[model samples]
Target: MKTMFKKHGPPPTAVEDATFRIRFAELSAGYAGHPVLHQLSAGIAAFTSTALVGPNGSGKSTLLGVLAGVIQPTAGKLHHAGGRPPAFVPQRGAVGDALPLTVRQTVEMGCWGARGLWRRLTRQDRAAVDSALERLGIADLATRQLGELSGGQRQRALIAQGLAQESDLLLLDEPTTGLDPEARERIAMLLTELVADGVTVVHATHDLDAARSADVCLLLREGRLVGQGHPRQVLTPSTFARIWQPA
Candidate 1:
C-alpha cells in the first residue's frame, strides 16, 4: 500500500488571514461536577502554533481535552472549521510508563485510530510509523523499551506516536515538562516544523518561553480566559502577576 505520510516541505509563509481552525464560544467544561473551564472563548488559527498558558489548576488540560474531543463541554459550543478529529498527546504522567512496549511499538499505537484494533497494519501504516520515528530522531531507540528510556527520550517517543496519527490538528499538554533544555528545544523545533507543514498545533504549557515562541497565546486563570493575542501583547508583566501572584 502507498504511504499516507506525504512529506510536505517547509511550512508556507503565514498569510494575514483570520481563518480559524477551531472556535470555542462561551465554552464550559469540568470533571466530577466541578467546573474547570468557565465560559472560555477563543479561536485557534489554522496552520498556526498556539500556546495555552496558565497556572496550575487553571483548566489548561481541561481545555485541551475538550479541543481533542476527549472531554465533553457541560455547556456552550465548539465549532471545528476543519471538521477533522485532532491527535491529542496528554502529559507524560498520564501515560502508562510501566507498559511493556518498545519505542516503536508505542509509536505504532498512533496508527490504531486509522487502522483499528485486531487489524493488521498496512504498508502505509508501517511507513507512517517509521517516518514519525525518524522525524522525532528516535529511530536509533526503536527497539528500546519505553520504561528504559530517559524522560526526554520517552517524551519524544510519545510525540512520534502523535505524529504517526497523521492528524492535521495536534493537541499536546505539557509535552516539554521535566525535559532538559536540549530536549525542550528539540521538541519545540519539531513543533515549529510541524506547523510549517500546515499542521495546526495547540499545546498547553507553563513555560513562558515556549508560550512566547508561539504565533498566538491564550492566557487562562481560575478557569477563565485572561487574555488572547500575540505573545508580546497577551503576556505582559501585569498579566503574569495577575496569574501567578499569591493571593
Candidate 2:
C-alpha cells in the first residue's frame, strides 16, 4: 500500500487555466439519512483565504471535511484549479498517534502521506520540510520529541507538517483552539504568509477574530448557508443570535 503511493504516486498535474477557483455546486454531504451540509454552493478562489464560521453543530467542520476529501458529498460537483490532492489539518485532537518521534520526524511524516514508504525523501522534500519548520519558527524544536512539546508547539508542528506537504489547497479545522492569544496571533500571521505564497486556505473556526481576518467568511446554520461573503456581512450580532438562540 505504501509503495504504491511512492513510485507510482499520482502524477503532478498543472493547475487549470480556466478554473476561477475551487467550486462546489449544489453539494450535499452527510451520513445515513441526515444531511450535515445541504445544497452547498461556494467558490473558493485560488490563493485566497476563506474561513468557515458557525455555532456549535452548525456543520462548519463537516464542510471542511468535504473540502479535504475526507467526506464525500452526496450531491454536486467539486471542481478545483488543479488535480493535486489537498493537505488536511483537522481539529487539534483529531490525530493522537503515539510514535515516539521527534517534532522534525513528525513534520516529515507529511511527506509520507503522499510520498509513501520504501522511497526515500528527495533533497527537495527535505528542503521543503526544513522550510516548513523554519516558517513555523520551530526550527529549534525540531529535535525535541513530540511528547515534550506544549500544546501550542504541538499545534505548530502539525501545521508545519501540512506545509511540508506543499499542497496548493489547505484545509484546517479550529487551528488555534488551545493556543494563547500570542500564539494565536503568530499562527494568523503565518497563515497570512502562506496566502502570500499562493496557497488557498479554507478553515473552520468559531473564533470571531479569526473570522474577521479571513478574506471571505461563510456562516453556516443547520446545514444551510446563513451568509457567504465578508465577515461584516455574515457575522452580524443578529445572525449570531439567530443561529444560537437561547434554549
On TM-score, the candidate that comes out on top is 1
Taking the tens digit of each residue's C-alpha lDDT, what string does model 2 give over 1-247? 0001112223223453244457666677898888898877777877888898888888999888887877877776666667457888877687674769899988898898777976789898899999999989999999998878888898899999999898988889999988899989998988888899888988899898988999898888888887888887878888889877853
The numbered model that scores best in lDDT is 1
Query: Lowest summed lDDT over 10 consecutive residues: which window, candidate 2?
Result: 1-10
Angstrom error of the Cα, residue 116, model 2: value is: 0.7
* Runs off by more than 4 Å, candidate 2: 1-19
TM-score for each of the candidates: 0.91, 0.89
**What C-alpha root-mean-square deviation, in Å, does candidate 1 show against the real structure?**
7.4
lDDT of 1 by residue, 128-245 (tens): 9999999999999999999999999999999999999988999999999999999999999999999999999999999988999899999988999989999999899889988888
- Candidate 2: give its CA RMSD in angstroms: 6.3
